[model samples]
Target: MVKHGEEGLGFEIVKAVLNGDIIEPITFQKVKDYCSTSGIQATETHMRVILSNSTKNSHSPTYKNYFERVGKGEYRILSEHRRQEKYFWLNVDATSYEWSFSDLKVGRSQIYSNTNPNGAKRKKETCFKYIQIGDSVVAYETGTTKAITTICIVENKYELDDEIFIEFKKSVDYDLYLALESLKANGDLKDCDILKNHRGTLFELEKKHFDIIRRMLRTLNASGDNEQDLHEKVKQSLADGSDERRARLAKRDSVTPVSYETIVRVFKRNPDVIAEVLMRANGICEECLKPAPFYRKFDGTPYLEVHHRIRLADGGDDTVANTIALCPNCHREMHYG
Candidate 1:
């Protein structure tokens, strides 16, 4: 029964990842949040138990692997209402990356297959194969002629084993393409380097990029005039903080009398206070009442977050009444938003 429950939780996590709602760079707290918002009635303990056991089950791959598979153009989880075989095209300006039957044909045929013995298939059999300039095919894998591509292509062909290796580009959604293009136009492409490198590490970075693009699409889809302004505001907020402010605030408040130096000393002695405070806050999430469990103190404790109801910079008193317990998600919202 326990195993079954864990499996259910694992499935939920996978579902969240596929939906692009899990928040990138899977963390325990993030997973917890996913569970909460997903309306799954599982506790963090249940989540941890299932996740830990799932990790050991051999059937379940690491969270990193899940994102890599999704990001590396290997697999996708389209909405159920969408047609299965039909491809989605992502258009940016004049260039469009699409997941058509032709693209899949190229990817499927370029590599050796059990049915084809010539080591070289006919051109028409690979109707989607096309050659692009200036890139080398690094690797190729075999699959059915129907697999989808989710990433975009930089070039069309790559050199491999002294042969002209054909490169099949990953397909992108229109919104993602425009987002990348916008970043490139603004010299912010480096912010999306992980997505470029196929590293799947973008999960660790702030979700501001993803959120911006998503919001832009939402606005445009709704024909809202404030889309650009909303995008800029979101971008500015993501750039202003490191993930360490919550910790620093916790340390500052841990002192016997709550002096800066004493807070530092207390934090040095007991780093867990941060997590303690957050736990005490019942994981209710200080901001928006959503589950946000990812937080730490300067000392790297896992609980007890320190929150200032009134901003010190705003001339709010530092008294306990003016302070309240908050989770890391709330702490960040307070600082960033």
Candidate 2:
């Protein structure tokens, strides 16, 4: 029996080289060059399998239905027969496993078929075969955070030593973490496959639902705030009593350290304002009338922070009239309490 691996492999290679315009035909020589550079072994006969003429030479019906020969060694994908781009919800147990998302971000994650028993092995095989280039995947951390952590575009799929591996290119960073509850709350995703079942590691997500999720993530995580505004937002998130505390309590022992990239603003304050406020208050806190927490090691000056009556970002002046010196405890209470 013909392995038909060439047909599958050729189809993916052609798909990757397809231009968005689709008006231009892809030449066999171009495909060959790509295969040569990409380390894909292919013969002229296997290359012909990517065209419609291959149907007469081989029993493989896969690519035969999609590609049509427009000229000698030139092919154009059948516009009407092209497969639609697929969307997937892939569950990654990043909380339980270290460095999973980091590896996934670099397109090095493996889809292990031998990790589980019969049913899981079958599912892994199906997912490996089903996912193709141009597909979009939303990776969800299901072990602990229960949030959609990253969005990825499927770039390549191949088998090595009988094990399947997928290469993914991260399209967008869902750093804010679209929580499971937030997804469940969306009306369009309420009946989504993963939400309804939540059984397997991979599930087909509807394009409409995927679009909604993408839009929601991009909108919620949009940045352009002043440092004070950003700080206030962080405070608000911490003060949110909906489910944060409960979730933290449940994962007290299972908690693992994870790092995320974020853009933060560091305020550049007027030094004269701090010096004048400290001079006016001496070594006492303006708020609590208490002594400074300690003396600075370098200059032996009392350690105190100048508190702004109204934040500078909120139109407060950077002068002694608008600032006051406070000890560490009083400053902490002024900001946190």
Candidate 3:
């Protein structure tokens, strides 16, 4: 058992571990290093004392009690508030811990319509033409009635009753409630266009309501953008095999093989044949039909080496019927394999 004075050192070690400086399965040398840095002048005996105390208190029996073992050790710091669950673990030199754990609450207030039971109600029915569901409204007590809360819609129409109901997706704080009361009493509700100008206020509403309004605005403004339709058309064409079918059936039938030396000789002797072949193949490799075969030698100099279909060693003659141009890989694979 470690003495009470040594418990202070143990506390410092715990602090270091929690601060992400020291880790579990910590070696004596590592603890010594931490003590040196922390100005504790710790010894192997002091480390053993602390380890014994920690192990005695540790809930897990498999956990190593002392540093005599050479292999790595694992230890956990159990939360007093939560006995069954370990909050953090110290592995070697890396300690992992949860930052925070707290419950979050989210709720909204209910919308209510205020109407007088004794007083005669307005004869005209409220005709809300431009009123939207997400529109913000002000609620306040009408006249000198301090207790009765009055809800003000965007407009006070002849058809609308004096009492209006505004739906709130979130519980408003005291500051917002006061502001709404001020706006309602000032006759801002008569100006329906003013609600449209208060978009910045609506955007500051609860995240759920803001997202709903933003999506509604997008749906209202979605027009004249056919780029997505054009993309779908191209995607359908590729998926339907039209692009691949056209590329496969293309005129890859007439390419002929001619060596780099033969090409130079032919260019000198019959420039017309070289030009005709280039025009027919459209300046592409006859084997792969890829444009501009700039083959280079080991010295980095471009040397186009034309291949023959039938090698002279195999009793193959030099005729267009048995000749085909090939890249180096295709040429080597043909000869070797």
Best by lDDT: 2
Lowest-sum lDDT 10-residue window in model 1:
260-269
lDDT of 3: 0.34
Q: What is the per-residue lDDT of model 1 for residues 1-337, given as tens digits with 9 covering 90 to 100?
A: 1332355665656555434354323355667666665556776665555344242333335333432222221222223411222111222111112223222422232222112234554333221222222212212111221111233332333223323333334333321112323334433335754335432101222345444444443443453434434334423433434344344545674333332221011112122333334444555655456554554443333332456575443345544445656666665555544
lDDT of each: 0.36, 0.59, 0.34
Q: What is the lDDT of residue 140 in candidate 2?
A: 75
* Residue 304 lDDT in candidate 3: 26
Query: Among all windows of ten consecutive residues in candidate 2, which has the lowest summed lDDT?
Result: 256-265
Tell me the spans in candidate 3 whose CA falls farther than 4 Å from its real position. Answer: 1-7, 18-20, 41-44, 52-231, 234-337
With a 3 Å backbone cut-off (N, CA, C), the pairs that clash in candidate 3 are: 125-159, 126-159, 126-160, 257-325, 259-306, 260-306
| Cα lDDT of model 3 by residue, 1-337, tens digit | 3332254565565555444355433444556677777677556776655554343444223222222332333333322311121111001101111210001011333332222234433222121212223344332222222111212222111112334342333322221012223333434233433333431111112333333323332332344233344334433443445345345324335233232221011111122222223334443567665654573343332222234465532344433345454555655555443
> Worst ten-residue run, lDDT, model 3?
85-94
Q: Which candidate's TM-score is highest?
A: 2
Evaluate residue 337 in candidate 1 and report its C-alpha lDDT on the 0 to 100 scale.
45
